[model samples]
Target chain A: MINNAGPSNSAAVLDEGVGPPSLSRLSDADLSSMLLIRHFEKNLLKLFEQGFLHGTTHTCLGQEYVPVTVTSLLGDADHVFSNHRGHGHYLARYADAEGLLAELLGRAGAVCGGVGGSQHLLRERFLSTGVQGQSLPVAAGVAWNLKRSTPGALACVYTGDGTWGEGVVYEALNITALWELPLLVVTENNGIAQSTPTGQHMAGDVRGRAAAFGIAYERFTDTDVTRLRAALQPLVEQVRHMSRPLVVEFVTHRLGPHSKGDDSRSPAELRAVRAADWALRYAAAHPEQFERIDAEQSRRVEQVVAEVLARPLTDWSPR
Target chain B: MTAPRVANDLNTALHRLFAEDERVILLGEDVCDPYGGAFKVTRGLSTRYPHRVRNTPISEGALVGVAGGLALAGDTAIAEVMFADFVTLAFDQLVNFASKSTAMYGRHLPLRLVVRCPTGGNRGYGPTHSQTPQKHLIGVPGLALYEASPLHDNHTLLTRILDGGVPAVLFEGKVLYGERMFTGGVIDDLYGYDLADGVARIRLHDPVPPDCVLITSGAMVHRTVEALRELLLHDEIVAEVLVVSRLYPVERAPLLSLTGPARRVAVIEESTAGGTWGAEVATALHPHLWGTLASPIRLIHSLDSIIPAAAHLERQVLVQSGTIRHAVKELVHG
Candidate 1:
């Protein structure tokens, strides 16, 4: 099918959001979850500056609404395959902020016993890999199994626009279409892949790619969780009951660097990205609920940081 | 009744696995009814278990990935990469994802996945079509390497892989498919085999003390046995033949006992020399077999070059029985 939206553009603003959805109407639970990821990511960058963290991390700052809303659409049994920048994906599913921070800090109570670090996290029903383009096939296979073993539960995988270059992505998509596995491939197309922008890397748009395989394609140019969920209710049901594979691409922005201090964008472009942040938009629309919940989530993340830091380092040995 | 062909036995094993369990899935290119498989090892399978056996597009990478995913989701996934040479296309999925998924993810997930590759050269299929790439996947962690030989039962081997519950790569030599199954504990009418140790130990029809042992696997076992038979008859030198199916995680006790009696042993394979499985076996055995009064563990392999399409050149590039005979005669006489 052709793209449900107009000519696909990766950098289209959320002001392109349908129904002009208001942020003030969003439930307090949803607002808290998004802010929890927001402050958690900001704290991680601060940790690196303060010399408290090692290696590197990819924070899903501007793209927090993708996982927050997508995970809400899924049930507990549905497998969530995350990518290198997957802190929001994990937090949205498990809500275990302390364990995730411990994983990054390599502390004793780390989620993966401190072995997976920030990128390669593995919890029950949720997994994240540091590699690109490999998770789609794995998720497709799991979806095939879920179709047989546990009907109605689907497999959802998160990837970036940069991952379209991987041949395995097409390979997985081809069979997923041929076999009709219940798979939801969510692409967080933030316009730029690492430092190279999408236009430089991708030839045609993602909609055409999905059309080539006959997979259902949907695009979101906004961060309206409630409205998006209401709109997606019937489509998500089709993915589960009809055993159809869907590609939901979110045209969002990377408010933070690709990894850590690797933003190659001009200063003007970076300022534009900051201005489009859902946090800033939410503050402008719902000041009372946004200020209270945002501060509370920020304080909660700081407490998690302090508590996870004091713990001893993880000493892991395989059996 | 005629003896079963190697391909038929494998086909039967796949059918049996699908019949025994509802979760067993076979994925491959042209695996379904009309095409069966390139070598017909999966013949008549999709007809019997249509939903369980699937025909995939020409996608080796995703083929292995889907198999790994099915295995991760608690299904016995068996995938076939048409020819062994193409196994290289699925190397990353095999090593990085399928192999690592077992242990790297916080908890243990039993990936009952098997990738079957029709390996080795002799039929003049040329460089890309007839190469043995099993050596590349031999030592990957959490992954097992196996081969199907005329002397072994496919059902037993496939069952063992499933029972172990780890991802495995089973190499089926291209030339071995048409060969008759060496059944009834006898081989080539000149040697007898003992499968007591889960690996075949073939010796003369009657008991005789041997001077050295030739360690080989898969289709190459036939050549090694023929060389040993010739060494006993013409050269008056008796050399034992130890045929291994499970190539990786080499078992020490059985190997030492089989080769220790002769004190002189050589590892033979179809892969080219430099970084071959023969070298790994020789290195692994030398330390334990030290001071046993032998020159050194010998590694007999094909020349380090691409296999050519010409039959004559292929024979020269691959290790022939004469090469094995020469290596053993030198070890015995000198």
Candidate 2:
């Protein structure tokens, strides 16, 4: 298991966030996905402002790379189970940005029949069990079912560092490994779980702990989409062909306080700081591709925002 | 003129089921290897079917959660709780997940699961281990409960529950584990009593007017019947007794139908009196049926505290068969 080893100082090297994939190389589809995540987060904020969105919202502002790339490796037949901060992950797979926006707005067109608001964005192919630390077992079950029924489909579960403390996750990890089930455990190591930083609260390395259970374990920076793809591609392929368990840990900054309920820092200040270096360096690296991708992302977002704003306020049709 | 063949008891019945169906896997703590179980009910199961009997870790919540998922995947998982007291850890999986899965999720998942809870207090295992926690689960809709007192009752109830594909709880009395019944005897064929609707066992007597009725169930029924048999020596208090073998989806029609002109009625239960079947029965019979009454409904129940360990202390706290007999006489004669 991942022992209580002290902070290895490798996190300090992430100051410039180098050695990761450049966003310049991202296809228009990937850029549209990234823009969808941003627009969804903004719309979620608007819903929270108007009192439509209930419960906590865990925006994947900084950690978009993990969902974007991991989902890129998944087919529609494959399944992904995520935690409360599931909007980014869910949309990354399903890509129904308006449906998620409608869900946050509690409209009839919402994916979960408008019953589950911000935290509970569940689609047919991609499922969120509407809980924290609870989806792993169900995901394992889904993986077990898939292994038996559909030989090629893989089940991926995304959990936070906070969920690592739960014994049920360990139980699921053990069972998945023992059964040689095709399960991918994705950990979003945001350095902080809500308020407490993982260095203080999390006992050990998340990936190493999974490795202790004999599951194939790997970790990367959440900003590094290409690197994540490289690491997860083999695992996903193995799940597709070999039926073995896999774990991928994406380490990065939360950039926001866990959810909308937390206002520990100014959102403008955090967004302003993160938006500068990452976007600028990527745009600088490849000018032609960046221009083309930016125009596509802008057009998609404008179209979605216009359509979303023009709709009636009240939901008339039954959910 | 005829004798019934030995249908075999619960343990042997389960052995037959496990042997018959490879999909029927038994899971719980101490179910394999060295320790068969706390009650030894599954003693020879592991030896019989090594791969089928799974001895799980001592995590009740995970055990039930895993069972729920397995059942959702179309596996017949019979999970055992050594003592009913420990079922509290698994109540969420039972009440929230399994019971509500079909209803809340629009029957997308078909949960064919059986939980065997060994309950009751005749042994020296104090308040913690002796509770009949079925009362807590009675309020949960969609799930059925099978409270078995006799060996044959359990066998019939298990088979009936297995045939019906909804979630069911089989509560076995700790005291009745070793009690043997002549399975070869020609017992009353109650195989047709709708498992969803409870069966009402009405012990017949000559010249039965059914003036007063006593309703009871579980281990208390054995004692209540014996005491009622003795009470028949002098007083012709021609009364009918309704034993609720299946606790949930309670056959209320049969209960109301069997009462006849029994104006006065009393209910005896060993579980907590509040929010129990006794309370529900009294509520259902009162108001409308008040005109047929010689007196109001009376209830004989256990004290509000947990059952004590000592047999003497337990008997003092809980209602005995004589207690039901006394209550019936007072209600009819008063």
Candidate 3:
């Protein structure tokens, strides 16, 4: 059985041979990627607080594992459409950190030429937008094109439980299933939307919602990297082979508030969630590997920050 | 080169485009083989290009969003919105996604998507169905806006837009769909005009020295042509008619050059007077023509009211030949 007690208990559950897989089982590359995302987000939060970054940012502080593991299963040609909370997704796709940072700072050197802030990041195969549920249909459209042009390629859309409330999600799901487009709809149900809890915003279960559209559904309560990779690899393969849409609702928690402005969670709740930080727990369980990876990620983040700071700031004025 | 009706010309354009490029895909509600389209503009397209032309559900947002996605994925897509009013349902996709994608991405996203909207009144489809919503789409940066005119070759225009490598919204006047157009001299031997820089000018009388210039587009071109004939025959007033095809990015040089020594100019359209295309054209022309004008440019348009279903009421509310004639006469005789 999977450890519902959270990431802190994941190591113990694995030692007892009771859970799916443990974070200690992740490859060096996978662990390094997750560490890089975590370090990058932490530094970004500092920059945001220092007023170096304009516009509000939605950080994926605790939800790094979901995107890291999911993106690992995807090939470079495959497309990814993400929602507002998409920093982790961008980093996982190996987007230039300097460009992403420049964009958040509203510089001309931004990936989107400073037009799209933190919420909207677009590479060749990766796209994210500020609007909720909008990317689902966009993913379906991309998947339709992939179905026609690139036979083996697939499209993945990362939405949230709050996005499930949007009517367009259902419309996109229906069309994706009807067309049998190769799409994977990842609902990162981080248990909250802005300030409201998921229960307040979501009606009915996500599994049932997927079932209504006659698509396959999977729920991952614990988003430990190894467990996620193990559960997702075969599913992604099946989706690519079958050329159909699948829903993977990841039930997790946000380590930080929704944005820089909102800090409304109770102290006890915050402490409890922080104690269950997956990376920290994994580090405690395996100290040597965690230290090596963490140090390397920290150095990389520091190097990127220094290099980006040394460059001239991009002009924010319209061309 | 065939002088078919505007609808048939559009069909011919689609047929040719499908045959030429495998990347071109046509999508909309009831645009399949049996249904073709509500206006039959996409007739026989699906039969010819079976998988390329697709019928979609009644979801306007998805239809447009999917078209944007297809374009981003390197396929040229043309989406047909049944009516201009239904374009409201697709504003998020067209304005937010399609228009802004390349700019937001800071790279050319290959968003070669065209949204075809059938606009205007006269068939009495009422307020919901017959609005000229092109005005709402005008000021959006990075979006190209075009209106089909019987005066210009729509086949060539469609081909140019598809090859233009941009996101565009093309408005086809519903009433003008069945109207026939020829290259020259159908109504009069003096109807000699050439399409230059997106503007087509038909002089009412050759070597007669136009007393005034009347500017219009879409179905209004037909009414303005008729009105010009009346003005020349009855009132002996020779006015040059300038029809604009690219509604946005209004090509001012060609229009101002063709206006040529005429002090009075009248701009007419089917949409409401407030913030209409006529207003934009007049605004653009004011500074350039201010010193040379005899009087202020005359902006003639429909009243700021919902288009009614009744024919007489619709006539009163919309710009007809009588209104065009009156507006032109006032501009010339004032």
Candidate 4:
């Protein structure tokens, strides 16, 4: 099995690229969304430790750019299907934080009325599932519709390195490519699948597998927000214009364990990953703006949590 | 409208649906012009609406999944699974996703999807090709299960389901597709009535009080009717046959009332004996009808074995007219 070299030096990865965008040039909404996601996940972890939260969550703590950048580029009509590690995607889709928190708390006001917890969040344009690789086929179906009914609309499904092992993903890819549906298959290759590393689960190259089906494939080696925006802007446009499926693989890292109660990584690996946290690096580079955004996001999260906590529990009776 | 063959009626329903709404799209393998469908229900549909009728690949899971997606996106989609047996490949999309999406998740999106499954045995297609899989989906919430019968208007049934804005699985009996349907005919001792709850009941011997109630659905209705005729003419025992159109969310009130003062009730289906639709009916009526019931409810279904391909053995395994007649006799005499 192929082992990941912990986390590479961010400076070396960044120095080779065009310099990071200045604070004014950056999207305030995107930054705030990332901050909110991070803070919300941190709160969830705390609540889980304190025995206040039930079940487990696969937090998108480190890989916030995946949703922040991609969802920002999507229109309200465009659809998104997300995987288990989809908290960031849910928040980025403009779902209210209280509704999400209430869902996790199993309240009637939750998005799914407490039936679907953290993993399954359903909205008009967004749908998330706990089942791995299911989003691809479902997204392909959505894309098939958009291709016929809505001309400019597109469907984007987010998967992980582990989900690539599912055979239905390839089946969906074949149909999407055959029909030339407007679908973007986003794979967040965080080099890990739950406790097991991705290399142990996946065989051969992901890009090569997608290429065999004649799908347009692209790989982003880093989770640099600006670079992601630049790369995806044209690609999303092209997909919408041509109404064809494209596969994009983003190589990133997860700073936290796979889920609650998972502590499989070594201390050195954990420290290395923490040192490479993209949010911390950005904060270290621009401390003043980071502090302001972090404070605002924390307050927003606290207010949402308070509102959710004040709500009554959901009726578990059959509807 | 003149009574047409079941297949012809289905074809006309597709034509009318396509003509009425541009949002109605048809998807399935070989569901195009020249080769309408395995049962010819979708015949000539692709020619009229080339853009709407899609000839999909042999991907049952993907086809159903895509239909769900289309429905979610505010389009009415009817996906035809050539054989009901192949629905196993799409259980996740149908049972888990399409059925549960609207109820478990909020009903933000309208899941107006109709999966047409051509089901039941007797074609000598063997175990894999011929099977009644409606029992597997009857209890799924947010999903309606409908079976087509020649006694009802196929056009009206389909139109009602499509306009209901819900996800439904319609099981079309393979053998019933070619059977002749009667629109209006008055032969002595034969009468037909459509219930408000989407059930079609045919009573043999109009003035005779029903000594027993024979419940069935789909193509089995014809076999039960034949058996009922035999019972009246040969055995001199009159029975009322209640054919359920909407099998799920089973309009229990109408069925219970229709059971009438009969102490003997029998449910005959073409599926297996254990955990079948007949079993559901028996269990649902057992509580209310127990005090009045002279004997236990009889569930007559095919034997618990794989359907054989041989014509002789297939006849023996399936619930034929002879089996129904025998079951009715046993229930009446017991």
Query: For this target, which candidate reaches the highest DockQ against the unseen true structure?
Result: 1
Which pairs, if any, clash in model 3?
none
Per prediction, the TM-score for chain B is 0.97, 0.86, 0.96, 0.95
Which model, 1 or 4, shows the larger DockQ? Answer: 1
Chain A: TM-score in each model = 0.95, 0.85, 0.90, 0.92
Flag regions of model 3 displaced more than 4 Å: A1-24, A106-110, A315-319, B185-190, B205-207
Interface RMSD of each: 1.3, 4.1, 1.8, 1.7
- What's the number of clashes in each of the models? 0, 0, 0, 1
lDDT of 3 by residue, B1-334 (tens): 6578999888888888888889998899999878789999999998888888888888888888888888888888999999989998888887788887867765555578899999999888898998899888888867888999887777688887877777899999999899876566444565667778888878743557888888888778778888888898899888888888888867789888888777889898899877778888988898999988899989988888999999889888988999889888888888
- TM agreement with the true structure for every prediction: 0.96, 0.81, 0.93, 0.93
Q: Report the C-alpha lDDT of model 3 over A1-319, residue by residue, as the tens digit.
A: 1223333211122222353344555777878888888888888888877777777888888788888889889998899998799988988887367788777765546787777888878887989988888877778888989998888799999988788887778878888898899999888876667876666666667888999989998988675777678888899998998999899988766788798859687776676567657887788778888899999998988887767666665654332
Top candidate on lDDT is: 1
C-alpha root-mean-square deviation, each candidate: 2.9, 5.1, 3.8, 3.3
Per-residue lDDT of model 4, residues A198-290, tens digit only? 656776767778888999988876556777888888999878998888888877678878998785977866665665577877787778888
What is the fnat of candidate 4? 0.57
lDDT of 2 by residue, A1-319 (tens): 0112245311213334444455536666776676677666765676677775666677876666668888899887777777778888977887787777666655545665555566544455565654556667657666766776789988888888777877777777877787687888888776556665566666667766887898887767536456567767887898778998888777655555567757453564455335533445566776777677767665676676557656554343321
Candidate 1 lDDT score at position B146: 89
lDDT of 4 by residue, B209-318 (tens): 88898888977977777787789889988888888888887768888888877799998889897667778888889999999999999999898899999999999999
All candidates: DockQ: 0.66, 0.27, 0.55, 0.57
Candidate 1 to truth, TM:
0.96
* Model 3 lDDT at residue B51: 82
